[model samples]
Target chain A: MINTEPSRTRLPAVLATAKNSDGARDEPGEEIPQTISPIRTFLMGRSSGAGVDLLFYGVMVLCAVSIFVIVLAIIFVLFQNSALSRHQFGFTFFKGQDWDPVSGLFGAWPFIVGTLLSSLIALVIAVPLALGVAIFVTELCPKFLQGPISFLTELLAAIPSVVYGLWGIFVLVPLVRDHVGPFLLKYLGWTGLFGGLNIGVGLLTAGIILAIMILPVISSLTRDVMRAVPTSQREAVLALGATRWEMIRTGVLRNARIGIVGSIILGLGRALGETMAVTMLIGNRAEVPHSLFSPAHTLASVIANEFSEATGDLYLSSLIEIGLALFAVTIVVNAIARLLIWAVTRGAPARVA
Target chain B: MAIEPAGVSLPDNTPGPVPASEPKSTGPGRNRNVLRSVIDHSVTGLSILATVVVLAPLVAILGYLLFKGFSSLNFAFFTQAPRPVGEAGGGMANAIVGSGIVLAIASAIGIPVGIGAGVYLAEYGRNGVFANFVRFTADVLNGVPSIVMGIAAYSLIVVRQHHFSAMAGGIALAIMMVPTITRTTEEMLATVPGAVREAALGLGIPKWRTTISVALRTASPGIITGCMLAFSRVAGETAPLLFTAFGNQFWSVKLGQPIAALPLQIYIYAVSPYDEWHRLAWAGALVLIVLIMASVTLVRIFAGRGVLKGNS
Candidate 1:
């Protein structure tokens, strides 16, 4: 049918062509031409091209989606575990002070206390030292000594926390237990906190270890902040007949206060979340102790010590809940720090403008 | 407050002459200067003391570690596997190899994803909500205790498979590595000049292509340094590996099986009561320290070169 239709349609074209040829006079050497089909070009153009733009946008969307997907996955897995969710929902999980896994009871109070106490101790030890290091490097130290001293201070950060744990276990703990603890007990034994029998692995040891771990962080951040203070400010203070120390205190430190606070907060965050070193030195006992010398547990150390053996639904859930608490704490700490830093540095730039 | 424009030197002690009309009183400025000197010296001394206090333990520990660990570092310690606790003539070959494999896997998985995210944040998403989200997430992840990551990895990867394996350990290490690399990569990419990006885009190149080819290339040295920092961090992590990889007894190359890492081995040996194990622990520590120091040195060199090139 299709062949017949094409032949039937060609009859009119043939007649028209014959008529045209009869009327027209052709040049002797002229060649007759065949017409190229127009429809074919449109079909080729349509067939050859693909949706390149669609593909590009598709990939970009995919790339962006993956990040959200990963975050969702974390939330899902954490929440999906019934063991973790059930225990976390209860008010007692956070409020209750006791945390004994053997009886299937869990409370985060002691761990929270330990985390706070250790971090606070670390801050007390590290802040002044870090400030000193920053000041010395930026203001006090001779030019030749500056590089080596700064390098030495930063080297502390390079050493792993676990190595610190190992050192604490072998060297620090022994020194503390044998000599330092004994001496402190003898001298300050009247204080209830220091009166306890020394086991060596307690708040003091953990704090000291944490101080060592966090010093470099504080020192490095403070040094950077101090360096950011304007040279003109330093000069102005010095020109005002202020001594070098006064210049640094009023000009450099006052200007960098927010940055310093940020550094300290960062250090505190590190102290709070530190795991292995605290796990090793904290003695991993669950009970809250009034005495600094008594062994304790932090949220991080608790998770590290027990998560492996945690088989029960409540036990596993409690651990996850502890993690959630840690997450919340860190977010809050970082947010506050960022805000504080913004406030401090924000004024300086505006004044400059 | 303005200084004289012409060539002139200001005297150190003289106050700018207050207008002569102001009443001149007793020269309390001199006494003030004396008080200032006292405060200055005290601050300087106090600051010096504080620096010394923070530094003392580091020096002491390094000195002690070298004194103790170096003595135990003989050829035998590196050539052989760890012996029985009381037995002698063993090294940390198995632990060393295991650590190497884990770190390699971690670097491979972490570097690309981290650098890509960083590029996105710095180039396309600067000041955008997504960038803010990523930044916050990265900070939180970095602050997430390594032990928690280990637990999470254990629950998700290790326990699901019902086995402890090196891959699981690698996954845990990668989790730790990601935040570090992300942070470092973002910082490094930020260090690259906006002019470079503008120049590339001005040529009509696609934004993504320009970012990958131009911006990333310029920031490569800093990125590498960041990677090294991340590597050094995970290399020494023991808690995560403890739960995910668990420790192996003999030398084994199987990724699906439990493997011994240097840090875990050190943890075990250091805590163990045996004298031989203690010696081996010290040896393992020394090796880890050397490896870390070497990587750090390499990173500093690369970063320094990048800075020098930028200056030139």
Candidate 2:
């Protein structure tokens, strides 16, 4: 019914003719001419379309299979040896508050506590600092200073975590041990977190080191998200006589809240997975500390410290379990990040619409 | 006359005559405002202070290392092995060569797979469900602890081989390199416009040819930068190499034998009680910092140039 070129009609008509003739006649004489016809060629050509679909799906299936394989390999390898799975003390592995590998007793409480506590500390420190830096660079800073300031901030990200660890051991640990730790202990001794003897290597030092390591990640992400906020929002706030800080607080932060949260969580994830720096400065004690100033271990530090020495079934399995724990945590964090990004970007269409 | 709220304007005639008398009393208020502005500026200055606190330790460490490391940096330091515990002079030549060999091997193994996978993602993916899955897996892989990669490589390669080897070290480093390289490659490829791909296809080139010839050509600088970043990251990785490579003291070019690297050497020496060893550790740390800083700086410069060109 639709208008079309005669050349386009030729193929479909041939296909139709072939279909009709094949259905109506069975004679050998009729088959020969029909086989040689354009209609037969058209029918043969369309049959190969499924081949294209097969190739596309084939590659997709392979990728899917690989993902499943990786997950399975991790799970199977961790669980295949049952001796490693027996933390038989009934939730004691998580809550036992001690790790004496020398006595063959392994509890992850200190590591769990250290990892979570440090990451939390990092998030608390970095989120505000990052937001302030982002706001300053985006809005308050002079145009000439913006380039250098932003570049320096991002350059912090390029320094490897090992360098941070090395620096912490040499410089940060000494400074904390000599001046900061003693001062804090003298003033804030009532608080258990500051009550411990100055060992120079403790949860607080690890947290501070992590905070520095994660700062650039948080700031860079925050900057990107803040930059994406449309200029009109800022103009509207300024038109109402809002100061630069006030405008950023009301307009930019309000809009970038979800993105900023995502950025913070991303930094948190980095803090959690940090290995070398924490291991170097954390004193590597396996005891769950009653105070933040007490030496402790992290999951990453534990694996880094003991994976080589981890012989026998239980030791190896426990370490793999730790890896699984890390993997699960990372996946969960990324999922949260993805959800936050989706929530923020999803508002765009509604606003446009 | 009464005016509507939307149409209201300032009474210019009434305000102008009263301004001189009012302005005289506003001086004190202006000073108060100035004080408030100073407070605000100081708060902003405090934020910069926080940034400085975060950055200062890195600077101080570098300065200390540079100052101390310079006295030891000589031709002999580059070529000689460590002296005994109390001995005077030694170098990290073997460590440097081992690191170079491992990095070269890791790059050779990782770059092709990473680039090919990235090509598959950017060109053929089409934002399909499979692409999303690949992306998520890549994220997970990136998050996998470096030590875990070390463990995996140890189990899969070193244990089977029944001995530590540089090949095992290279494989472990390669695993670490893959996720980084893949992520960077995908990002770089994504930055290459679709129009370039289409243009190549329109000119009768096959999809594979178009991807390799045009898209990859455009993304090469970015790809190289990514590779360099991956190299910098893996070069300093000690945990993975600890068990697999199992540090060597003698000069070793053999892939099957254990090897020494700058990070492992630094770690071992730093932890040891010997004063001479500690000095070597400092020297190794200095070499490492220089290498990392240099590679990262180079990549940033190259990547920035690529981005500038892309924008233009």
Indicate which candidate wins on DockQ. 1
Residue pair clashes in candidate 1: A84-A317, B80-B91
- Model 1: what is its DockQ? 0.24
lDDT of 2 at B23: 57
Give the clash count for model 2.
0
Which CAPRI tier for candidate 1?
acceptable
Per-residue lDDT tens digits for candidate 2, residues A53-113, read: 4564455345444543554554455444323544454356666665665666667777898
User: Model 1, B251-272: lDDT tens per residue?
Assistant: 9878999998999988878777
User: Per-residue CA lDDT of candidate 1, range A176-276, in tens?
Assistant: 88988889888987876585768888998999999989999888888767766656776777666555666677888998998999988988888888888
* Interface RMSD (Cα, Å) for model 1: 5.4
Question: Per-residue CA lDDT of candidate 2, range B1-312, in tens?
Answer: 122111112111122122333356657765654554565567567667766665575577668889767765778768987666677887889999999988888888767666666766777774988777777776676776676666667766787899999999997787677667766778888988898888766755555556677888789888888888788878888878877887888888899999988888877776567767766777788888788889888788987887677555
The prediction achieving the highest TM-score against the true structure is 1
